[model samples]
Target: MRRSFAFKCTLLVIGWLLVAIAAVQIPARTFWPAAFVALTLPVALGLNLAAALYWLLRNWRVAALPALVAVLTWPHFQRGLAVHPLHLAGAAPKATAGQRVRVLSANVRIFNVYPQLREKDPASPDKMIRWVASNPADVICLQEFYNEPRPSRHDGRLFQSVDRIGEQTGRQVFLSRTLTNSIGAEFGMAIFSRFPIVRRGTITFDKLTQNHAMFADLRLPSGDTIRVFNFHLQSMSMDEKDIVDSYSSKAGLKAKGLGLLRRFKRGMVARSVQMDTLMRRFEKSPYPLLLCADLNDLPYSYSYDQLADHFQNAWATVGTGVGSTYNGALPFVRIDNQFVGPQWVVDDFRVHYEVPYSDHFPTTAEYRLK
Candidate 1:
């Protein structure tokens, strides 16, 4: 009798977790705004589904509650694990009659030029240049990209990576530096395009650490002008040592966890403000807009919802499967995305997992004006 009572208590606890998980889809900034709590929703959904299966094996009636919650919250599951019939057709064709353009977005993470991974392979820089040259994206958006005026040759000549990619691909490159020195050396986001850039500008966020969004107006061969915004939002900014030390002891765990949570909260709040700043400018744009970004937030969060509310996500229309874009230790989350205006029809979208140069897998999409 006592064992059965304990089982009931455990089941009750699982059910409440499922409800909280489902409730996170609420479209608001402050209501249930904690990232730690929001991050558990995916895990809770998995546990709930497992419990539903277990209960069904014992008695069909006992499984209904968990099963129903999972079913009712099906949209969230669909977002993370979708399969489409269009995969057999492959990516959309490149521009032949000047109607379609292929765009690629990637956060290169400073070309992996840190001290710890110095010995791994210096070939990553060349690999990226060759990949972009061979793959041939018409427009490329890069974030967390680095540049140095007189970087040591040992640092892999990342100072000229932007110009190298442009020369290799025969595209025009424009950069927006979030960090700069007095000697005209800097690091920031960049946009490269085959089409002619008519104008360029940067949108600076007041409270962000080292991130900014920049826009370029390109004149296509068809004479259409479109504005492309490449943005890297605020990141959690947790170091590798922070993660390793967190698990070393109970005190360390508590301290590190709190520190990470504080960072997460700050990142989310800052991203919200930055997104609002972008949207206001986006509204005033004279041409059709395309947004390529490393949002550092999940699809269910307020940050994503607000940005996606008006724009159409390229992956949702053309991508198959979960389309996970992050290549970090936690593998399933997709924080990088490409969003287009309604005037474009997304013919194909894909996450390039083959490129293992950075913590993020590059995402590419082909679209034509509707």
Candidate 2:
């Protein structure tokens, strides 16, 4: 009787694990699916451990259920393991000094505007600016670059202080978009170049939202024109409404029994449309491109795979160590990236986590023309 009871309980846990694993594929816009999957992944492992204990206790055949649960959680297991900075060693061809260009891309998170968040340290802006001053990169691409507005009553200039960065570094600065209109202050994307910017243009994506790519034609000291593309992609949105309505919610269970099917179908359709639009624009660029941005996706994800079809990941070339670029409270994901084309060889790459002005750490790379 004791053995039978233990076996039944183990089987029940295995069923629960299956339900959780399937939630990821379900069509719901809420946070519940991801939350539940995150929670249950570990619980599934614990249940598997319990099954092993039961096997030792009574030699029951039910131990296989927990082992099966572990297998089902393999995707999450891979995600956790693949978060490091991948260095593509031996990928870049040799080049002389003038044939190489060093570029740096950083999403400075509007200079720590969301200070309440875990990653935005108070000293981050100053540290990053100082670092930029010292580094003297040939081409610097900045997302969340800020320009000060008019003086406020309490503070003379809010972000105006950032303008001094380019002046101090002796690099020409160009803004891609403005974040605020007050005092004519704006923050968006900006490029600082030690060499002359021969030409620059912007590409905008139309998806009921404003997402853009900024391109700069850099005339290198060697007189070669290399086009650099910098962009930030559409975020997952993952709004509060989505979180509350997700499959892990109590409401999710109620919906599962009701007309929840329609809601999930709509959500999936919308997500697919957004991804398709983003990919189309990426496919049309007409240069030997060196693209950098906060891609907001992982290496093994569909977004990464699609982008990799046209460009090589620079971090995989020369980056060493845990190259995770997001320095938020969790500190696990590597959403920031650098992707290059066949025209250039990646020489070295680094993720600057010590300077935390933004939610993301800055990623820099050295490249040589092939």
Candidate 3:
């Protein structure tokens, strides 16, 4: 009778855990559900081991419940680690110095007003501009390149500012026109190169948000023609009403649950579409490619996986320590990245967080042609 009671208790515990796991998905908060699933898998496996040990001592069939939990959760654990830092490190190829190119990638946040950083101080843009001027890079890519819409004193000259800086450093600047008419000005992606650009063009993706990829064909000192593709992917902006309704106190559990499901499905579908479009562009490029962007997806995500199949992450090769690039108060991940083709060798990589010119920190990688 006591053995039967223990078996019931063990089954009850396992069921409880399973319910909690399902609940995480039901609310459809992608990051949280994914994280919860990841963390619980290991614990479930450890519990199974303990149960097996206890079962050997007391001869109870209840031990199978924990083992079943382990079997069920193992996939989730592996999937979580699929996007971990270690995997990123392992995927990078070794570096060589002969064909070295130093490159910088930064999202200037469209020069938007960020109150968190004291924008009134002259030091804000000055520091960022100074870094760009001084950094010894062969190529520099800037996203969210803003120009004043009207002929205002602070507007039309944005590109000139970058160009002048590049000229001072002997780097030629190539800016792509993504948004011909944005609210503040015309904005897009820009590339400044120390090497002469042989060709350049823009690749557009169908996204729920306005995003684009800019390409530059750079002729290396080694006589190799390499293409650099810089891009910004779709954002997570939902309708204002939808956001309010999902999170508001008046939203009941069922309503919130359904809302979350719809949102998650929408985001997933949108990202898939964007990735497909970008991948096609990458496929069409003839030259050896070096791609950089704010992917907006986590390292272990499907988007990252698809890109990894084609390009090697520069950070995983040469970067050391936690390379988080977002500068928000709660920043905890490296969403910014530089990916090079198999023929490139990355010698050094860095995340520039101290330069507070934008919400996203700049990333730099030194690479050599093989």
Best by TM-score: 1
TM-score of 2: 0.64
Q: Model 3: which residue pairs collide? A: 83-300, 99-368, 99-369, 100-368, 101-367
Over 4 Å off in model 1, which ranges? 1-37, 43-75, 88-98, 148-158, 182-184, 207-209, 244-252
lDDT against true structure, model 1? 0.75
lDDT value, candidate 3, whole model: 0.66
259-344 per-residue lDDT for model 2 (tens digits): 44444344344443444555665566565677887765555344454565567777654554436887654445687888888888
Q: Which candidate would rank higher by TM-score, 2 or 3?
A: 3
lDDT of 3 by residue, 32-79 (tens): 354334235335444555665666567745556576666676443332
Highest lDDT among the candidates is held by which one? 1
**For candidate 1, lDDT tens digit of each residue in 1-370?**
8547745854765766655554444433354355455566666667778778877887677778778877886655555565456553654453344378889999988776565543566777668756765667889999987666565556545556666777656889898877776655667888999999899998888743458889999998888999999998878687757866788788888889888767767777777777778889989999988899998888756667666668878776666677888776664688999998888877778898889888789988888876
Q: After superposition, how far is residue 111 of candidate 2 from its true place, in Å?
A: 0.4
Kindly report which residue stretches of model 2 are placed more than 4 angstroms away from their true locations once superposed. 1-98, 114-121, 149-158, 207-210, 239-286, 320-322
Residue 45 shift from truth in candidate 1, angstroms: 5.4
Cα TM-score of candidate 3? 0.67
